[model samples]
Target: MNPRRQVTEHLLRTYKSALIGFAGVFVVGVVIADIVAARVADPAPGIWMYVAIAFRYWVGIIAVIFISNNLRQFVAVGVTRRDFMAGATAVGVLASVAFAVFVPLGHGIEYAIHGGSGFSAATGFREFAATLVSCLASFVAGSAACAGIYRFGAWGGLALVIPALLPAAAATIFLTTDSDGQIAADHLSFPLALVVCLVATAAVAVLSHWELKDVTIRRSALG
Candidate 1:
């Protein structure tokens, strides 16, 4: 098998159960939230909103786990660092795309059920595009943070968190609020926000690649 393809398949296989578990939990949470919102007087927050938050956090957690625990194994098994990084990047991008598509679909279902009364779902093309970029940004940020930690240890990891957070923050601001952080009745225009998010994602990818390429794998404590 091609090294990059092998690494990608390894990642997908290793993470499959965890990702499925997370998705199940997310769906249950959204359903419960929808039920509660139906009985409430206030306008319910959107399902997609909850999805965005959960997805961002989940990606971060998974990235940290992967980098902390699995990279060395891949290297030991003859995977080149470049191949591993490429595969990991592919995993992140694919996961981001899946979330981007599914979240809006979930929102659409909720909207139909609730008659568009309570939740603020993103059902439009522009909104979907924004959501897609935001998901990608969050995944990249998480991957970058993990790479930083793997490359630089605790102190360096702490230092790198801010840069890793930029893309996720930009995505959140773009998706949920005006440029000034105030909640708006409608989503802000996508041009500037998208540009910022794309830039942040690019920055994260560059940083992660720089950290991972040609780096030595740490010895596992159990060794």
Candidate 2:
């Protein structure tokens, strides 16, 4: 089978199960956390509870990406670098769109439960864009790492994801945890995101060259 079809089919099959599990887990976790927080602190609606729910989904998105990458290896079937990059991007983009809606919706939920809005629509949109970039970075890195693993077994390939994640992670820590509310890079971070992208591409290229050098090209043989 062609790499495109192979990757797409695998992604669909894997993520379908992931979606089911995610809904069940996410909903249950959120509800439990919310209930517990309500009992512990503030009277009626709780802002912290809503924030917790939002953070849970944010983390959930990353978990899905990681699982999909690991699943690529767990399955006996082979996947190409092109397949990994392309397929993972599609999934990441879908998740990014969800994040776009989720952030604002969470804010809206907060407004409904609590009295005033903690953030304005514009700020929410900015954060959404940053979050999208983060997800994209993660997807590209994940696919590259998976491709490397497919070529070099486990340890060597796993190293590939690290370089790709560094800059993006640096960007994440700086923007996410800072007291300031800006999205633009600061000092060294100005080139951090770009560097990560470049490193990730290099890793993908190296591993992919090896993987394609002697393609196993699985055949549908005698029945």
Candidate 3:
């Protein structure tokens, strides 16, 4: 296997337990909620919609750990900084895609559990697309934030905070799902919002690479 592919697999293996736990917990919780809601009131918009929203935040934290914690460890193991960033980026995007697929699929399962035909093809597609881009934005933004803090001191990192968070913030503000599981954007067209989010995410991912590529790994107490 290629070095980058090996790094990607290694990172994924390290995160496998967390990833499974995340999805498993969400699944169990949503099922319980659906049953309770069916007994009391109709569950609006399905639990998966809310799960989709949480996915971005969850992946964002993962991205931070991928950089702040894993970067130095991977580099110490003879991996190039460039390869580490590439592998991490690939992992982030793949994780986002997985959540995107899961959200819509879970929505359908929620409908099945509720004994309701609440699932709509159009809504599912909208949810999938929105979640994918938003999570991507969140992941990349997190990477940028951590890269800034890792390469520069805390004070210097503060300077890049706003721009580093722009993609995730904008995605959260614009692409929103309603109570009925329908997605809508605040100001821009839905498609346009996705495009802008993708562009911003790409830019920030590049910036994170630039910041991390030649980063100086400071000595720690363990070493």
- TM-scores for all candidates: the values are 0.84, 0.58, 0.92
Model 2: per-residue lDDT, tens digit, 1-223? 6665565566667666766475566556655655675677665343432332243234334433543443345234556545654554455567656655665555445545543424566756655554555545554444444445555556765666575345345435444412112344454452464455445445544544454344333221100
Error of 2 at 144 (Å): 2.0
lDDT of 3 at 167: 92
Greater-lDDT candidate between 1 and 3: 3
Estimate the lDDT of model 3.
Answer: 0.81
Q: Ten-residue segment with the worst summed lDDT in candidate 3?
A: 214-223
Q: Residue 61 deviation, candidate 3, in Å?
A: 1.0
Among residues 3 or more apart in sequence or in different chains, the pairs in candidate 2 whose N, CA or C atoms overlap within 3 Å are none
Tell me the tens digit of each residue's lDDT in model 1 across 1-223. Answer: 7988887788889898889887888888878877787678445545545454466556666666667777898889988888877787678777777776765566667666765333343334444566678777877787778777777786877799789878888787775532221233334566777887899889887887787787768895112
Q: By lDDT, who's the top model here?
A: 3
Clashes of each: 0, 0, 0
Model 2 alpha-carbon drift over 4 Å, by segment? 1-10, 43-85, 115-117, 177-223
RMSD of 2: 6.6
User: So what's the TM-score on candidate 1?
Assistant: 0.84
